[model samples]
Target: MDNHEFESESYEEVEEDDVGHDESPQVITIVTTLPSARSHRLRTRLSLPDSGYEIDNVQSTVSANMLKILKKTFSIPNNVFLHLSQDNDLPSFPPEDKVTFCSDFFRFGVRLPLHSFINRVLCHYKLAPSQLCPNGWRILVGTLTLFRSMYNDDHSLAEFQYLNCLKASVCSRWYYFHPRPNVSKFILDLPDNNKNWKQKWFLISGSWGGELREDGVVRSVPTHFGIPGLIFVLYVHTCSSYASLHV
Candidate 1:
């Protein structure tokens, strides 16, 4: 496809609007892509009617109700996480507003732009937020590592996801974040004192994972996809949509 040429994808219909609301409808136009086996994007421009939202001098807080509207429009789950188009920023999920939520992204200076849903991602979450980040308690409670404990509820399928090696009825749940950069070769968050973590970083990926040695050895196992075409795709497609907030 050419850079200027566009592709269109048909999306499902939102339910009929109820007549009982006193406030007129509001619209939120969203353009996002789904994860699949194809190269093309599944896109839509959804108008959220009466989708409650709030804005202040400092922040924009979208209503949890909008999740329902989005699910209706896109045939996705209401609890699915919504990213502000930045693959690095922590995604927004249920029970919290998109902007005001306390997140790793905010702690690391990742900001939200206006029209955040533009090129945003609708992610299906399987793990808790704390699990995704981590708060320490490794030995007593177990390190919050990245192996799969898929929340698909069926233990057999979860086992299948983890190659029957680690994900067997584990107490943790699996979550999906898009693939990040530099897994095989380099990078480290560098655990400090009690601020972020107490111990050295433990490396975790898909079905395979490992505890990194203090000597900086590559003990961690490979992810589902290695440095093949996926990493190249991410490298080329790392987006700038979440750059800054619109004033």
Candidate 2:
């Protein structure tokens, strides 16, 4: 990956919103009964007003868009695409065909400056045409800028799936073998609590909380009920002391 591919997009580069940071995500309210999804209609048809759902909370199109970006990015470098076409050594970072990230990480329908988005992507997570190379070197998309030097720490790579739920299929992501569980069916360090989760987790595939950004930005984020799941956040505190780190 080239350094130019990802840029540090601070507020300076992008037009700063006159609102607060916490009010960055877009939310939609569905007032009337939602219509069942059909192939012929535009996705915008799903955005119902009044009845609310946090469109970003569950992704239906982001996986496709992100995947498309990675695929396109991989093909940009000369011979990179031609090379990875033969092997998955350039492993797809998350590898899973589904999405694992929750609202705590990425927002939907929020239009950000190109540099800003690039900076956010490089904050964490690796990207590939569709594979991880033998050297374990891959491009890191920053959560908020990555130096893009293709650094690889085998130890860190080994734990990639652990820290990231975006690594596995929904069903297995909450299993005993997983490092973390995004679903309420499981709890960290409490393996016993996750037993028979297959029976407990339901596919209501409905219910999305609506958020009105404090920044006053409105976005029409696309969504679907295909992979219905619940989000259960787990907080771990080993000590009473608090410390802050700067990068």
Candidate 3:
């Protein structure tokens, strides 16, 4: 189980004729371990082909019993494709190209070209890029808070307040960036506004996902490949085959 002793091949040296489009591009595989409350471990394998990448697994084929166990453990969707590189030869991809994550696991980063992926992640999650940072953080924090409140004992009011709190958190965080024209001065003139001050401004803004876009997409399209272990495996394969580019 040494990290250094991953599956790898020796460098065979790329031939002069292997430099151009006529020659097949190198194939890289990434294997990863995904943490889930369900099974003891969910191993995943990803292979990057010249055209694109595919996911697989190394353990026994995911049977009905295994899937049922997973579903009982986690409320995740049941229909998932599982493959192992050992069953089928891994695919390949050009070094210059990249793979984009269509799933919730990837916020804004691509899978290929590790450096670019890291850079994009830092910019989207950590760095303040323009005015979108506040809204982005609001969504992130609100989602986390909502998950936390899920453990609360059944109370109708508590559930309602939980949703409201999530909305409020998102709206308040965003308001720090874009402040609305206040009717505060006009509050004295309009006494009704003062009395009904606990308005649903936050709900209107935070709940409206259709009105706004998440990174230029109409919806938050998350590609659920299921296991991180598969991805980790593929990444390791890619690195291991670094010298095999010549072969």
Candidate 4:
């Protein structure tokens, strides 16, 4: 979708009392199925909010936008997009896509300039085009700044569903697995008995076999969830740790 199309739609101004509310713009991203002879429904509607669900969180719209933007800039010489698309070895660094920089690893392999890094990060996240606004840009700036400071390891990605009674149902279906009994127990046992809560870990283990490096210690790198899933899992584990301590 183009900026003009997004701007045409109207939104009602929501009034706030005392506390500040999230200011990221709301977007109704419509994903239309590729037309086939038998297809009747033209499109599907997905309303994505900026705060919780980052751009990369949604598969349909955000991914589509990435593909679009990627195609458009793929030819730019000496640009990250160009390097990502090139086949042969080049003197310049490959595109940002090849690099694994996130909130966790700030000044790692890539030495992207502040604006360049921000642009690329936003692109990777598939943030809305309008986030270029002063307020949204400020938030984006702060987020990136924080990422640079905490480069302990790779920044893991997680998908956090807003807290509510129906959270169990939401999470169960999302993970495509049945709920474990310990889910409740895990929460009840939160660290320091923080009732307000934080996150819950999605226990996942699969075939990324454990191996001993040159040193004898064994390290098991997970193969199931990528950057996105890892982020969500980290959040859950962090929150659950605090919760468990209390119980």
- What tens-digit string does per-residue lDDT give for candidate 1 at 148-247? 1324222222222122111111122221221122223111343443343211111111221112332454332112211111111111111335221111
Local accuracy of candidate 3 as per-residue lDDT tens digits, 77-183: 33332222233222121111111111211222211112222233222222111112233333333333444477543222222222221111222111111111331
Instruction: Supply candidate 2's per-residue lDDT for 104.
Output: 11
Local accuracy of candidate 4 as per-residue lDDT tens digits, 172-229: 1111111123232112221222221111111111221122232454432222222111
Question: Please, what are the lDDT tens digits per residue for candidate 2 over residues 4-64?
Answer: 4333322122112321223323233222222247621111223223212222122232233
Q: What's the distance in Å from true for residue 219, model 1?
A: 38
Better of 3 and 4 by TM-score: 3
Candidates' C-alpha lDDT: 0.23, 0.23, 0.25, 0.24
Winner by TM-score? 3
* TM agreement with the true structure for every prediction: 0.19, 0.18, 0.20, 0.18
Quote the RMSD, in angstroms, for model 3. 22.5
Task: Tell how far residue 241 is off in model 2, in angstroms.
Answer: 62
Clash count, predicted structure 2: 31
Model 1 residue pairs with clashes: none
Better of 1 and 4 by lDDT: 4
Q: After superposition, how far is residue 19 of candidate 2 from its true place, in Å?
A: 36
| Candidate 3 lDDT (Cα, 0 to 1) | 0.25
